[model samples]
Structure formats: C-alpha cells, structure tokens
Target: MDRKDISEKYKWDLSFLYKDNQQWERDFERVKSLTNQIKQYKNKLGNDSETLLEVLNLQFTILRNIGNLYCFAKMKKDEDNNNSMYQGLTDRAEMLMTEVDMALSFIVPEILNISKDTMEDYLNLDQFSIYRHYLEQVMKKKPHILSASEESLLARTGEIANGPQNIYTMLNNADIKFPKVIDEEGNEVEITHGRFIPLMESKDRRVRKDTFKGLYDVYSQFKHTIASTLSTEVKKNVFYSRARKYNSSLEAALFQNDIPVKVYENLIETISSNLDPMHKYVSLRKEILGYEELHMYDLYTPIVEGIDLKIDYEEAKDTVVEALKPLGEDYINVVKKAFDSRWIDVYENKGKRSGAYSWGTYDSPPYILLNYHKTLDNMFTIAHEMGHSMHSYLSNKNQPYIYSGYSIFVAEVASTVNETLLTDYLLKNTDDIQIKKYILNHYLEQFRATVYRQTMFAEFEKIIHEKVEQGEPLTADNLSNIYKDLNIKYYGKDIFIDEEISVEWARIPHFYYNFYVYQYATGFSAAIALSQGIINGDKESRDAYIEFLSSGSSDYPINVLKKAGVDMTKKTPIEECVRLFNNSVDEMKNMMLTK
Candidate 1:
C-alpha cells in the first residue's frame, strides 16, 4: 500500500530465534566456551565408551547451536545488507568456523584408530547404543580417512583452495557494473543484474538486443579471470576425488551423500534421449510469438496476449495454500502455519540480497527470503521454498543428528512436486483460454530450463572437468567453444544460436558448484511421478510421500525416493516428464491455431 511497506515488507521476522543482539552475543560466547571444552576430548577419546559418547554428543549439541546462530545472523544480513549488528554477527561466525574446525580435527583420526572389530564390539555394548549413528558414518570413511597431521594440513589449505571462488564472488557480486541501454523512448536505462531481466523481457526487440549485448560486454572484459577461477574450481574437485580414492570427481561428489553413480548417469542419458520435445516446445514458442525469427532474448516474453495476473504478496500466499490441498490436511496445515507464524519474508527491502533461497537450522524453524513483484513466478517460488521448509521440518522431527541433512537428489523432489501440483491446480481451475495457455506455456518453459537446459549444463560441466583432469588447458576460447557446441545440441536446430550464449556458461554460479545442476533435471522427473500419484487422491500415495520426507538421511537417498515410489535408478520417470512436456507443447500449438 505504501512505499515503506512495499520495500520493508518483503522480509520475514527472525526475532523468534533470538530476541536481540545481547542474547546472540551470549550464545556466541557459549559456543566459543564449548569449543574450548571440546579440545579436552582430543587425546582422551579412546579411554572408554562413555567418554567417547559424551564427547561426541557435546560436539553435536555445540554444532547445532552454532548452526542456528550463524544462520540467523546470515539471514538477517541478507534481508538488509546495511545492518551493522547483523554484519558483525556474520563476521564473528566466520571466525568461529576456524575455531570449530580446530576443535573437531582430532575426532576423525581417533575414530579411525579403533579397529573395525573393536568398533563392532563397542556398538554391541548397550552403554554406547546412542552413538551407533555416529560410529556408522565415521567407519564408512575409514578407507579414506587421513592421519591427524595430514587432515589438519588439508583443512588449513581451505583458505587457499577457496580463494578463487571468493574472487569470483567479489567480482560478480560487489565490483562488476553493467552499461546503460538507450530505450525506444530516448531515455537512458542503467542496467543492473536485477534490471537485466525486465530489460530482456521488453516487448521491443531492439531493447532486448541492446540489453543482452550491454550486460555481456562487461562480462567479456573480465572473461580471462573468470575462466581461470572456474578452471581452478574444476581442478580442486579432481584433486579431492583422487586424494580420497574415488574413481572420478563425479563419484567423489556424489559420495558425500552416499548416492550411486547410476543416478547421475541415468539423468544424463535419459534427458539427452529426450531433447526433441524441448526443441518442439521452442518451435511452438516461435510460432505463438509471431516472430519471423526468435532470438535468445525473445524466450522470456509472454506468448499469450492480453492476459494479466499481477498477484501481490498476500494473494500469492493464499493461492499457494489452496493449490496444495491435494497434499492432504497435514501438509496444508503446515503451509498455513508458515503464513501465520512469519516463516517468510514477502518483499524486497533496500540493500537485500538478490534472488531467493530457503534456509533453516536444526534448532529453529525454516525461513525464506523473497523479493516479490506481482508476477506468477514469485507465486511458484513460494510453493518451491515451502516445499523445502516442510521437508526440513519433517526430516528434523524424524532423524538423528548424523542423519538430519537430506541429499539434493531428494531435495528437488519435494520442491518440484509442489510446483507441478500448483500448475495442475491452476490449469484446471481457470476457464479463460488465454490464462490457461499462459500457465501451460509457463510449465513448458520450466521443463525446458530445468530438464533440457540444465542437462546441457551438466554435460558441459562433465566435459570441462574431464578436460582439466586430463591435463588440458582451459582458456576462454576453449571453454566458450565447448559451451557453444552444447547449445547447438540442445537448441541450435530449433532457435538461432547466438555466439554470445556461449559466454553464458561463465556467468552461471552453478558451474562453481561441481556436478550440482544435474539434480535439477532428475528432481523434476521424480516430482512429476510423485505429484501425479498424490493428485489422483490415493491415500497410500499421500502417506508414502510424507513418509519419504520424514525419512531424511536415515537411509540412502535413492532408497528414500523408492519408498516414495519414484525410482531414479531407471529411466521411466524422466520419459514420463518428457511426455508431459510434449503434451503441453501440443496444447500450446492448438491454442495458437484457435486464436
């Protein structure tokens, strides 16, 4: 209603976790003292069973405490970047990380000192039953566990190994600036990363062209440095994988959650086999937009004419809850609590972080940060993040400390399931042909971006990391050309492939994450199958899904997903998602003809 409310209202309340700075300071000191106490267990862990359990439990308690404190401070700083108190708290947390690292450095080696037979014998002793979960995890890494001195040395290298990514973040987030574009109205518009989206979505083709060139022009200037940083990141993955005795970087990365290599390969092969449907969807876009030739920038503009659903914050929340009813009373109730209990930040405030993320600690409620405009995209984001929060809540309620962190493989399933349910609900609820077409087109676009586009990224990531692992140099031109080739495979035959899109890889932050984007494709596939079952009103299906969410990391990620009735080991779920994409493309084309 008012400017202050519009800007400030976008943030969520964090006061429930810590009332004020004085209390937060007290918690910080408490954690620091605990860190000191933890060192008492360094050389003393192997003395007896009771001593080891007490030490491990104390460390877990301290960690969860630090997690809550750090997350709260970081969330506050992200909400309003200019807040000095929040800034100080974030800085202090980073410092405490080193202290925490030093305190726990001896535990892994000490655990490794216990013989396999002795560990099994100790687990059978009733007095140490509480630490069974902790022992199980440490023992799995026994082959890869290094000596205490080697482990400390590797940990110390974190400052140097992490330097390149820190530079990339600084350049992208703090230092880089984009040139302004001259609008058709003859006014100059300065381009920011946030403004780049609205500019590319401009109805005027010239404005879109200018915005694309203007943003990349700045990126081109720093291309070499960015390329080097990316190269180092890939090499770092290889180094760790080899040191840990994994077969490849992909194997080592997936090993973090104990996921099988089959899941990753199945995603790549299945999605690669289904690229035609996405190409067909792009062809439909070109026809509906009536573009004589559609360029990369034309992809974001709406294809359906005279259709507007400018949903504000409150409207978005209600619609999200209503659309998710198929998930049952308990699911809907938690969503309602998110609204009533201030679990979300609904609008953007000055100096806040860009984009959106779902964050929470084991000790506190899940919270979300969003810079909402009145777009349909924002509504989908609410559903997306609530999916994560509700998943965390269920997992924390059901699992132990060692099993609380769920894998990204299953994390995507929960979020995408929410999106698909909302899409199906909206299409069935609306009779307006234009709105229906708009929503359907939106769904098709997601399938393209998440499934097809991300698979291309996954392939590119694999190729580059392999090149680095094989001792190939990764120059700017070499990286660009490989990226350009992948674009050709996905969209070259359907849409015009601009040379500029090749550099698009350098700008993506996910590239730094090392074999991470493939899950977006697999997650969507699993969600498609899971949501269909829930929407069909099967009580067993609904119960199975809730159970999957509650299972967390107690079992293998693939096993957890299979219990929910979606198997990533096979290719059927991905094929079903591709079929869904193809069906939507047909619907869009048919609607265009009728119009």
Candidate 2:
C-alpha cells in the first residue's frame, strides 16, 4: 500500500514536534546561534559550581532543541527516502549535530580537570543535584578523556569517520538490486531487501532457494566494495579505541555504557556451551520439514502447517494492548495514548525505509515507524516497537533530558520483554492445537534468531575485531572464511552450511555498528528473566520493571537491569533462555507426536 493511500490516523502526527517546516527552520537557526554561544564557556568549567551549572543548562537547552530539529528531519527523510527536500534537511541536521558535538567537546576534559573533592562539593550543592549522576559518569571516563584540543579534534572528525557507514547504507538501501526470481506461482518477481525475508518464509522450497541465491548473488558481486567499507569501519573502531586509550575496541564500546567486559565474554561463553539446544532445534526443523538435508535457505520456513495467522493493523494494536495488560493500568493507558496520539507511522510505501524502529526526542512524543504487514510476525513487531516507545515516554516524563535517552544495552530489554509477554499471552489464551503449536514455534524461532543467531554474529564480530587488532588483513576471503567456520560450528553437522551464507557477513549492516549486535542477544536473555519475574512474581516485580523503564540513563545500564531483577554480570539469564528454548522444542516434539 502506498503511503498516500493510507488513512491520516494511521500516519504519525509529526506536528506535535513542530507545526511546520518553518518552525523547524526557526529552531534550526536558534541552534546555530546557540552553538556559537557555546564557545564562550570553553575552558571555564572549573570557575565555580554555579558557572558549571550555567554552562550545563545552556548545553542542555541547545541540545534539546537540536534533538527536536534532527528527529523531525530524519523522520521526514525516513518517511520517504526519495524526497530530496527532507534528504537535504537530514543532511543539514547531521552537520549541525556534528557542529554541536564539536562545540561541546571540551566539557568532559575540562570538567575532569576539577579535583574530585571539588566535584563532590559541587554535587553537594542543591543546584547540581540533578546533574550529579551525569557529572559522575563524565568523571568515570577521566582516564580516557583526552586534552581539550585533542577531544575537539576527535569530535570534529565525526562526519569524516562516519563515511564508511554512510556509504554502506547507500549501497545496501539504495544502490544494489537483486535479480528477478520465479515465485511459487510461477510468476517472476523482482527481489528487494525488504522482500527477501518474506520470500525466505515461503513454504515452497524453490522460492526460498531462488530468493536466497538471488539476494546473495548481488552481495557477492559487490564483495570487494563491501569488504573495503567494512574494513574501514573496523579500523575506525580501532582508531577511536587507541585514541581514547582503551584496551581494545570492545572495551571502548562497552565502557561507554559502564558494562563490564565480562558481560560480553560471558554471553559468548554461555551460549557457546549451550549450543546443544540450538543443534537440537536444527534437527527438529530437519525432521519436521522432512528435508533430506536442511539448508540455510530452509531455516526460516515455518515447520508447522495449518497455522497461517494473518492479522490486520487494527487487530495488532488491540492484541498488543491485551497482551501487555500484565504491565499494569498506567502502562496500558500510556500505550493507549500512543495509539490515539498518532505516535506511530504504520504501513510501507514506495521509498519508505524498510524495518521498524522506535525513535523520538525529549521534547516530542516517542514515535515508531513500521512497514507492518498483515502477519503474526508483524503483530509481534508492533508489541516490540511499542515497548521501546513506552520506555522512551516514561523515561522522558520522569527524568531530565540528559537522562532521558537509555543506553542500547537496556534499550532492547524493554522491547524483548514485551515480545515475551505477547508470546506467553498467545500460548495461554489459544486453545486450538494448531495455534498453540504455531506460537510455540514462533517462540523457538525467536530464541534461534535473537539468541543463537545474534550470538554467532557477536562471535564473528569478536573474531574480526581481534584479527584487526592483531594487525591481520580483513580481505573478503579472510572474513568469509571466519564467518563460514562460525556458521558451521553454531548450526552443527546436521545442516548443510551453504557457501552463499559466507557472503552473508557482507550484507549485515550491524558489523558496521561497532560492538552493537551483542546487545540483542544479551537483551533477549535479560527480557526472558524479566518477563518471568513479571509473570510469576508479585506486584513488586511489575513495579520494578516500570521503574526501570522510567530510570533511563540516570544510572548505569547494568545497575538499572539489576534493579529490574536481571543480573547480567552472571550467566544465569543465558542459561534460563536456553532452558526456555529446550522446553519449547520439547513441547513442539510432543505436539508433533500426538498429531
């Protein structure tokens, strides 16, 4: 469906951000003026607590306005990437953001120069109470904080450093094209990135195989270019890691959120030891589908038949509301506000960005974008994105602007918890054998994709970064070999590890995101624990989860999650998730046997 044909109520009301572009432009100019004003406070942070507070307030005000301006422009661009006007707006907004970062670059180093006793004295003042945690976080980075000039130089190079990711986004989203493939109906359809997954879900093995080959054929063609882009991104991570005096890129990435390196290592270690369940899942898929040899192309195809649930957008909203009622009345009311306040841009259109996300700034309502199709998967996606939106809403309402945005570490926890609740709700409420089997299958698949698959990705990321850190070359052949080997180990000997799956690394945009994909796996595990707590525990459990949502970046992400009852520092969550996966698989086996 085209965006224009979609009803107005389905579209997000961006006017809540600004009445018009003219208003946005006015804020744009105001931000530019404020950026210039920020220069006056340079090197004066230690003058007094009052001076520090004043500068901080000005910085916050400028950033708050900039957030609204950038959110509006980028969201406009995402609505239709083909729109050149919004494209330009997004570019300008990015540049302005860079300028602001450069302007405020000295804040950290200058603040760090203050003696710890002096910093504590400032924190004791009533005026600085709210920013106490913010300042403390800054202090934690004191060792990595460079000189003022060096910091400013690093900040100024931000745009240049983002060149690799920008190029990859254009290539993946805009430039590459897949060959036409014959569908199950014997009709030739041009393949696209957005259509690739749905094609993989086709029951017709021919369609799935054809789409897999067709999609990878395009990626393989651009192997050299993509490899170069990926290599540059890795080197960029290395550059920043060394520049900031971090032990490694992993350290640098995790340190920003104050997560212990062991957390990352523990996730990998626990998942590695628990690969038996994943292999069992692969065997189950092979047996149920009656595949002589299960291939990578066959992984996403549904194992059960007679359970093709198609849910429209309206039904998805209602189902999500029903599913999330365990979160409490206030939580449900916030979700209702999201539904009624036009906080979501639903449906896909020509040039609309693919995938789904929840985004917004402190000054505006949290917004979500989805290319929602009428399927059970799309319904779960609605619940997932709404989880993020509600987290943002609660955090923004309760915390200061600086603390409003949560870390990516805790970000996925909220979304995945919602998904877990939805799955549990569906399983408990449905009496039909087919529907129960389908929901159980979906749960298993979630573990496979989110936990097993992402853990494999995380391992691949670690291998490549370690190689780069050791001064090993990252050519196409080398990267593919590493990925292929990992794929073999994770999927086990029961499945055919297709050669095309090696080039799969070339297409994943997350590799460009330094040390980011690991969070999905960890977050899924954390969500499993949190969801269990909410379902099986008392009102205190539910209240703690809500408090975690509203806490935002006020505390370390690990601490926030601990308060919510998940101790990510240990391997317990990963073990629990694997246990859940095993139980679901066993249930599926029993259901299949009875049938």
Candidate 3:
C-alpha cells in the first residue's frame, strides 16, 4: 500500500493494550489518587527499618503502574501523528510525570535525612538487602544532597530550561521558509526538509549546490533566533552542573554511567590523529565522481556508476534475516518474531516523526518505525533498529525494573554491529562489481557521517558549552565561525569549505541535547571492535558481547562494555575502528582503479 492508504487504514491497533479513552481516563484518576495518598509514608520512614522498606516498595509498585499507562499512550501517539485521541493520551502522560514529581519528591531527601550512622546500621540488617543497590547510587550524591526545600526549588526550574529547544523546534519545523532553487529542468522548486536528502544525492552538481545554498539560506535568515536558543541550551547545562556540584557539565553527564572524561577525549584524539584516511577518502570521491574540484555538495552522490539495486520491502526483510545469522540462533529468532509480529510500522505516514528509533517499555515488545526507500541504506537501517529490539528483549528478560533501560553509551553498539555484518554479508555474496562498489562507498559514507561528523559535533558542543560557562555570548557570528573552522579541520585542504555551511550548526537538533552527540562516535567505534570479534568466530568474545547486551544499566556503562571486550577509556578500540575505515578506503580505491 502507498503511504496515504497506510495512514488511513493501517493505524496500529493500540486498543489491544488500553481498550479505550475511558479506560485511560479511569487509570489517570487512579494514579492521581495514589499520588495523594503518598503522604502516609512521610513521618513513618524514619521511625523503623521495616516501615522504611515498606514505603520504598510502595513507591516502586506505584511507579510501575504509572510507567505502563504512560508507555501505552505515548506509543499510540507515535504510530499516528495526527490522531488527537492519542495526542490527548501523550499530554495526559506528561501530567502523570508532574503527578509523579510531586508524589516522589519527599522520598529521596528524606532518605538522605536519615543519619549516615543510622543508614550504616540499616544496611547491616538482613531486611535492607533489597534496597542496598539503590542506596549506593544515592550515596554517590551524598555531598550534594540538599534539604527538601532546595530539591523542590531545583525541580521547579526544570521546565524553564526547556523553553529554548521548544522555541527552536517551532521556528525550524513550522515557521522557517526556504527560497526556490532552479532544478535541472529549468523549473523553480522550493526546498523542504524531506527534499534536502534526495537533492543532496542528485547526480547533477548544480542541483546539489542549489539545494545546499537554498536550505542554508533559510537558516541564515533567522540566525540570531537559532543562536539564542542554542545559547540557552548550553547555559542550561552549565547551570545544572554547577548547581549539582559537578566540576564541569561534561563530567556531570558522563558520570551518570561512570564514564571517564578520557573516553570523550580519546574519540577526538583518535579521529584527529587519523585525519589522513578521511582526507584520502574525500580525495578518492573526487576521483570517482570525475570532479575537477570536490565541493561539499558533491559528497553525497553515489561514487559508483550505474547499477541501482532496488530490493523491495519483502526482499529487504528476507535479506536482513539471512545477513544477521552471525548473531546466533536465539538473536535471529527474536528478529524473526519482530518481522512476523507487525512490530514495525513499515512506511512513512503524514506528520509521523521523520527518521527511525527503537522504542519499548518493560511491559511491551520492542517496536520500530521506518521510511524504507528500497535502497541498501534503508536495509541497513532495518538491521540497525532490529539490533536495538533484540537487545531490549534480552535485557528485559534478564534484569530487574531498575536495570531494564540501557545507557546511550552502549546503545548504538548493537545497531552498528548489525550494519557491519549486513555490509560484509552483501559484499561477500554479490558478484556484481557495480553493486560491490556501491556497498564499499556506502560503508565509507557511514564512517564519514557517524564517526567523523559526530566527533566534530562533539568538539563543537564542548567549545560552545565552555564559552557559555565562562559567561561569553554565543551569538550568530560566534557559532557560525566555530562551525566553519571545525569543518576545515575535518575536511582539510582536500575539499572546499564554503561560507554557507556555517549555518549548518544551527539546524542540528542534537545540540539541544546536552553532551549527547559524542556517544555516536564512541558507539560506532565499540561496535566495529565487537563485530570483528563476532565474525572471527571467537567464542569468548561472542559470549562477552552477548553479556554486554543483557546488561542494561545494572552497572556503569564503561564496565558493561568492558565485559563486552571493548574498553572505551583507552585509545585502542577507537584507533582500531579508524584503521578499519582506512582499510575499507584502500579496498574501494583498488576497486575503482580496476573499473
């Protein structure tokens, strides 16, 4: 079916879970009532050890119910973006978050209020064993743990900090307008976000350059507004870090998973040291495309000549299942279940979120949404999202409620590892030279975007955040200059660095998410190492990687990856990943010569 048909008739049946709006309304009221009754535990928490345990368990059980309700409603809204019924459902879920914030506000500070000596005695008791694991995390913040009034003050300002990103989204997604660019046929065409990707992939150099200039022109028009929003977001990070007594914003964010500063530093250092390989890859693209001077607009065009292997959705599913057998029978079986069970929404629908993500709660199956275009890129995405689903399945089966969610640090490993396997499988099995060159170019492109581009983003984020922390203004000119300079460093003198690319920094949604983009680089690096181990048929390594998948947030993310055999703290894994990128470039260069 086409997208319109799917939008009208193929909306997911969320009724199997919640039944109706009336049912959701009933639960919402029930949760509100539960929240009001939370005061029963207040004074009694410090009276005796047994009472404290009962109060904590009550909080957990209540939260589990709140989570189920929220997940069901949010997932329904995600499947069909225009559905007002589920839109109400998501709004109600946010209300539940507020209810939770009010109800649970007393628990933490009160627990901290109990004297350290008294808590030590409580830990010695056999009754407190269940709560011991949780108490350890609390104690880490012991020095910064404030009075109940101060904690309440902190929570109150939370929504104020969200204002910047919300405004930016409104301006970018709904208000911004792009100028019309002349197409290959000598007709004017307006640029939209959806059109940007396909235009960048145009075989005609003029079309690519026109689209690039037109898109950034809109961003450049409102550069000041975008600058202010980005500045607010960076300031939000610095304020919270200082308020929480962390040395820096980066330390505060990374320390949640016990990740070291060196991991972030290592990614930048390793990618920087190996700049020649990336420069070589770009130069190779120039040769392959027969360009006299390589421009940024020419980079996305397919380097290999004519053989567009368009496998439809049916064929793509079968190929993914076959390509992933290196993950062993159990993993493949779960993937098969996802394929057969309608766990995925297969096509893009109007107003549905662009791009893809793997989402689920503890109570539901992992689900995916995709805009599949029957290209190798789309198939690799399928392999990627399914990797997340299987990883979720394994963790939910083995871990407790608190440990069910995995860290972003290791989140991309499973997905990228799947992509690596799929690429290798396609290359080994296909005899077509054009198809092989396409796949090789595809791998090189993936490395360029995910590893090289993200590291540049990470560095940009660091510089901008530090400037904000030092009370320096993050104006339009300031941001654009920093971004342009970084582009020069990464692309080197081999490619042109145009002034239009400066506004590129303003368009990225990732910058609003504090210190989040660095994980993309670290994750791809770790995945390369893990994929190599699995493909080599090393039993010890295979078991270790699987163990990492099963470990959610039960331990620090670094420790979890250590169990998986790739340590991010050291420079070895990142260097090894870049070396793999070099080797792929070498292979592609040799292939192009033979052609």
lDDT of each: 0.81, 0.90, 0.81
Give candidate 2 regions above 4 Å deviation.
none
Cα lDDT tens digits, model 2, 371-445, are 887877889999999999999999999998999999999889999999999998898897898888888888888
Model 3 stretches with alpha carbons more than 4 Å out: 1-4, 7-17, 72-88, 120-130, 174-195
lDDT of 1: 0.81
Tens-place lDDT per residue, model 1, 1-595, is: 2225663434466877788888888999999999999888777777877777888888888888888788988887776665678778876776686568767878888988987787788899997776786678788887777888777676666556766665686577556778889876778987765556656756678998999988887888888989999988998989988877888899888887777888788878887787787788778778777877878877877787887668988888999999999888988988898888888887655566667778888777788877676778778988999898889988888887667878887888888989998998999998888899889877887888889988889899889988988899899899999988888888746688777887887788888887989998998999889888789999899899999989878877888988888888888988888888888888788888873
Q: How close is each model in CA RMSD to the real structure?
A: 2.5, 1.4, 2.7
Candidate order by TM-score, highest to lowest? Answer: 2, 1, 3
Candidate 2 vs candidate 3: the TM-score winner is 2
Worst 10 residues of 3 by lDDT: 7-16
- The lDDT of model 3 is 0.81
Error of 2 at 536 (Å): 3.4
